[model samples]
Target: MRLSHKLLRDAALFLILISMPVYYLAFTYSLKESSKSRELIVTRQLTSFQNTLKEALWNGDSPYTRQIVSTLGNIEGVSSVVLYDDKMEKIQESNSPSKRIPFSHDMYKELESNQVKQIKTKSEGSFLVSLITKKTDQGLEKLGIIKIDIHYNDLIKSAHARSRTMLAVLLGIFILIFFIQFLYLREFLIKPLSDFEKAISEMNVYADIKLKEDPNHVFEIANLTKTFNHMGEELKNSAGIINQQQMQMINVSKMSALGEMASGVAHEINNPLMITTGFLERIQKAVQNDPEKYSEIAMHTEKALKGTQRVAKIVKGLRSFARNGSKDPMQEVETEKIISETLELCFERFKYGEIQLEITKTVSGKIICRESQISQVLLNLLNNAYDAVTEMPSKNKWVKVEVADSADQNKILIYITDCGPGIPKDIASKILEPFFTTKETGKGTGLGLSISVGIVEEHGGKLYLDHGHDNTRFVLELPRA
Candidate 1:
């Protein structure tokens, strides 16, 4: 349960726990008060009846006594009235003979005063009892005894009515207390925690931590907020440190790749330079032998310029790859353009008669990325593919590269395969680990796949070996711009 609900429940229970005796005491007091009021009413009526009886009996007026007895029987709350002689035998009763009322002898034993006294008093029972007395020369005369049954049904009904009122008042108090408690808890406690929860959910790892402080927050929750703010600051700092370390690692991997690509890039450039030198020599000779043959000279100049352009292209591709690309912000770049530019550095692989290279490009779109880092990743994978084909004994000795715009709108896929069985299932899991190369010790740095994995993931993409391919194929997936 929520804290607010639990608090409300406990508060209600506590009010009940504390109020039980109070409710019971109030109920009891109501009954007692009703009894006292009823006794007062009956006593007043009894007193007046006793005076009337004294006058009537002293005159020995039989009709007046009969009239008094009959009037008493008809009085409200008086059930029956009975009269007795001084010897304690029944003399007369107000109730009819057919409706006989039994008078208990135990009432005299239960009385607080002597039953034979001149003017003794007793309590209400099935009958009310009193002594009829008159003035004498020396003392009050003992006349006779009278018993009347006084009904107190109104007393009980009044007590019940008072009890119900008391119950309603107590119940109102309980509900009011519970509602006030809920309001207090929701305003001061639950709202602050909910705000804290929302703040935590919206928190960013890279941003500076600054939690809002509420002046009305509970003391305990304020302390918790302070602690979390401190922790958030620590995390932000840690994220900065981690990013710095990652940049350093990326740089180290790039330099390692550049060192490995240096030989191939130089060889590719050297071939173009040599071809340009031969074409320039032909242009010079043709110009020296026949100045009139302007077409031949112009044609030779064009051929020489083309070779030089080839060398310039190789040098440009290498320079772009060598530069640190981490400083560059992400922007849209042609996917085909980067692939073709990166391929220039690998031309040395195909220059030799031993290796056959095939390229396929069905991809068409722009991708947002840091270009130099993407190129390094491509270079790393391409170099791995080249090395795989080189080590294979099969005469096919080919490296195949395919880049495709994925069927899904969000992605682009690149596959690099060589004429060899795909990576074994056992160590496929470990191939991305840094420094876990299968190649000969001096030939492979082992950081290639690891760095490639990091670079691709940094772009919110992935690099993995596709075991479904018939050959050793590295699959690279990038988000389409």
Candidate 2:
């Protein structure tokens, strides 16, 4: 059964069980009291009649004796009356047998011993019998007995009336109690539970939420609501922490991939840069012998020399990125310098792949971090941007890297955006997961973003893929010293 019905049924059954014995005792007690009242009335009358009859007999007044006997017989509920001598001989009677007294000496004595008694005297109803002893003038000597039979109807009727009244009162009390109990349960228990269900259904699992505090006076439900609120706050905080850790793991994986890619690029580029530097030095020496030749060739050689130095600087930067591993300590490093160094590794790749690269610096700040790890992260981002643009069918392929101070003065933002087709919405969330990649098999390790994410986290920063843009923009936020 439903809870409401069950509660009501059980309560009704309890009331029934509890009230029956009380009512039974009440009815029985009422009957006994009615009988006692009847006995008292009968005893008093019988004693008065017996005293008058004895006085009449002693005074030799037959008329007075008859008058007294007739009066006692006429009393209400009096079925019969009989006067008996010491030998159990009937002397006077009303409503009795005409032949003889229908009672033995033993019966008379037993009946006389008690003031009143009820007996089922072979009639349809029981009768109350009261006895009075007739004594001499001084009341020292017993003369005879007087026995009166009183109908028990009045006593029975009074008892029945009292029992009915008690039953009616009990029913009213039970109804009132049931009505109040149902209201109590509905307000304090049932309604609150329904509201709780509604609140839970409407809540967003990913968002931070605080449940409304219960305002009930009921102790158990109030405590339960408090516990739910506490547990929900803890879960929301835990989810935030988990999301941060997941981003870290993704960035670190990407950085690890950068180390491997930079190693080969550094070796291949350094040799060419070295030969270009040698040629530039020899050309400057050859032009120095003639004034006209020197003047004309000096500017060209100087430009060529600057070109070699620029290539050499890129080679040196690639070497920094090519380190197999890193365990560097934290230190203050210029934000612009790190971005410039990382671009050296990717600039050649973007040019060779026919992809345009734009670098913008809006703010300059010294950030505290392991330089190698931060450089690796920036390199991996640029490398991914290259890949994104390379795979696109667009004729104008470009990657933009913007470094700016964040709204919070304590932090800086690096925005690496690409002109290629943005990350698919369906796979965006999984992009940072280990071994999760959108690239064709063997073309990507899927760990590039994961490793870079970890590195960002170690520096107490954030790395995340920005959504709702025409192109993908990966943000790296770092704290400044």
Candidate 3:
């Protein structure tokens, strides 16, 4: 059965079970009370009958006595009202109300005591028999006795009828209460829960979206909905962060692969470049004695050597940078060494762009870090600086690198600043966010700052923009060895 029907059924059964004993007790008490009422009424009537007899019999008027007896017999629950003397002589009689009372007349004990009583006598049948004794101021006068047949059985039957009626009323009230409870639970409790379940069943597992709120919900349901919606929002935000982290990892993987290829290619080209440089050196030395025919050849050879050496320097920078140094040993390297080696990877860009580069060493110390990773950080910053001022005129373009110790003397600080317009206040905070960039399309991937931030943090350092600077400046702080 559905929950509504089952709840109602259980409630009804509980009511019936709980009410039966109460009904029985009520019925039993009612019957007892009815019997008491009947007795009291009968007692009062007997007293009145005796008082009437004392008046009538005192006058000794036989017609008046008969008239009182007839009037008494007409009262409710009284079958017959008859009078007799102590010598067993019948004086007056009334017709029986329903049935005749075939009772012995000798038992007039209740009338002797002036209270109501039912006397059992041996006769042809059985019935309620009452008696009364009349008295006067003269003495204990047995003026007359009444034989009243009170209908005890009828009184009991009436009590049973009334008790049954009351039990029926109580049962109806219980049913009505159960029915009302069922409707309330179905509308406010059961149906709302079922609707919530259906909404959940239709929701997508991968999506983090809010469930619609029901304005009519109770506190418990409303609280549940609020918690669910809050959880969905939290999950949605967490998913975005997780996806960014995943993309960062993928990009790092690609860079590591490219680094490995660069390492391999540099190794293959190193021997040929060295051999060619040696041959060109010997040719220049051998042709130096002849000025006329060998001058152009020597000049061309010098140019060839210069270009070849530059290629060699670039190849060496590529090899050094291409090292996957995440697990490399941390060491204390001179501040000058780190800067000079990192510039080798991007020095050509500065020269090609005619961007004046300035280097300042306010404080000198060995920094504790993985050399290759630190070089990567410096290279990224240098490249960004180069790109920043690359669009400006030669005279207007400049980049500065400064090395110093932090105020606490516990960290090494490297500041790279460019003459390009500084990052806007609005976009500055978002620069470190993955895939968020200010550069035009194709010029930047936007992962550089985010990945650099991660790298510096792994090395127990920080990389952040220095808002105090007038131009675009980045501060990289690493622990001092």
Candidate 4:
């Protein structure tokens, strides 16, 4: 069952569990008390009968006693009437044809004791009767005992009837209470929860969904509704921001790829340009002796060609730096050669900033990797290191790159360290996230470290910042090829 329905049912059962036993106990006690009261009335009537019999016995003959006994037997609800002398001998006995007295000695003694008394005993045909008695006189003459057995079967039958009636009433009351509680729960809890569910479903279908406040709901449900609505709105706003960021990243990747391709095309054209420039320089030198001749023309041509060739070379280098070429099949690569190519790309920046670059190679072995991607990762790290050191005071400026084999010779370790203001402890962990930059706005796109991390990961390697030392160190460990 649904949660709300289960809650309501459990509540109803709890009430029944607590209340039913109390109701039964009270009903039973009430029946017993009613029986006791009836017995008291019967005892009083027996006492009056005893007085009449005593008056007749002391004032007249046997005829008067017989008259009094007959009158007592005629009383309503009286099953059997008996008169006994103080010595415990029966004087007179009368009973209806439907009833019979099984024993009277106990009843006589109980009556002669002068205590008003009543008791229950079995009668014929599975029936029960109450026997009661009282003293003969007003504490004067001790007369014979009088006993009256009233049919308790009638009293029990009456009690049973009353119990049945009470049970019916109680069942009706429980039904009414259950109905009222169910209605209250549906209105106060269940309906509100259903509405909240519907609102969520609608929000999933149409973005930026809103739900109206339900005035019919209770305070708690209203608060929950408001919270759900607020959460939906917040999620919608967050989704929009994520979508825009995704688009931006896509555009940036495309631009980077395009820049790389342009660099490669420029490099291809540089070789031909250099050949043309060399031929023009030779022609100019050969014609230098001729005045107003090809010497001047050739010299100017050679200078122009040289300038074009220089431009071509610069373009070629820029293309090589930008292009991220395809990965080559895994093969043994010279670690030193990879480091040299990467450093060559960052040479201009290092020289321009007067930042010293150092490389310490402690191992010389072929490592396994795609040379182009490894070169890109190294280049990016070197470039970042150069930038970090260049930003610091000249006297303290230096960047170091180191390559070594792992202790087991099963892997290679590359470490890039820079002597600059070290990465802050708080922001160090988040530096690898794409588009998260510490640089000034518009100065960095922040994809360099993130992409480098991806490349290293694809090579079955681990890349992390080691803050164990004073200077910031980025360590890359790649598995042996």
Q: Number of the top candidate by TM-score?
A: 3
> Which tens-of-lDDT digit does each residue in 61-134 have in candidate 4?
57777776676667656677766665656777667535754555654444434455555655211112222233
Ranking by TM-score: 3, 2, 4, 1
Predicted candidate 2 versus true structure: per-residue lDDT over 133-152, tens digit per residue: 44446764445566666665
Error of 3 at 8 (Å): 5.3
lDDT of candidate 3 over 355-410, digit per residue (tens): 87778655778988888888988888888888778877658688989998899999
Model 2 whole-model lDDT (C-alpha atoms): 0.74
RMSD of each: 15.5, 8.8, 6.7, 12.4
Clash pairs (backbone) in predicted model 3: 111-131, 111-132
By lDDT, the better pick of 1 and 4 is 1
Q: Supply candidate 1's per-residue lDDT for 355.
A: 71
Which number leads on lDDT? 3
Worst 10 residues of 3 by lDDT: 120-129
Candidate achieving higher TM-score, 1 or 3: 3
Ranking by lDDT: 3, 2, 1, 4
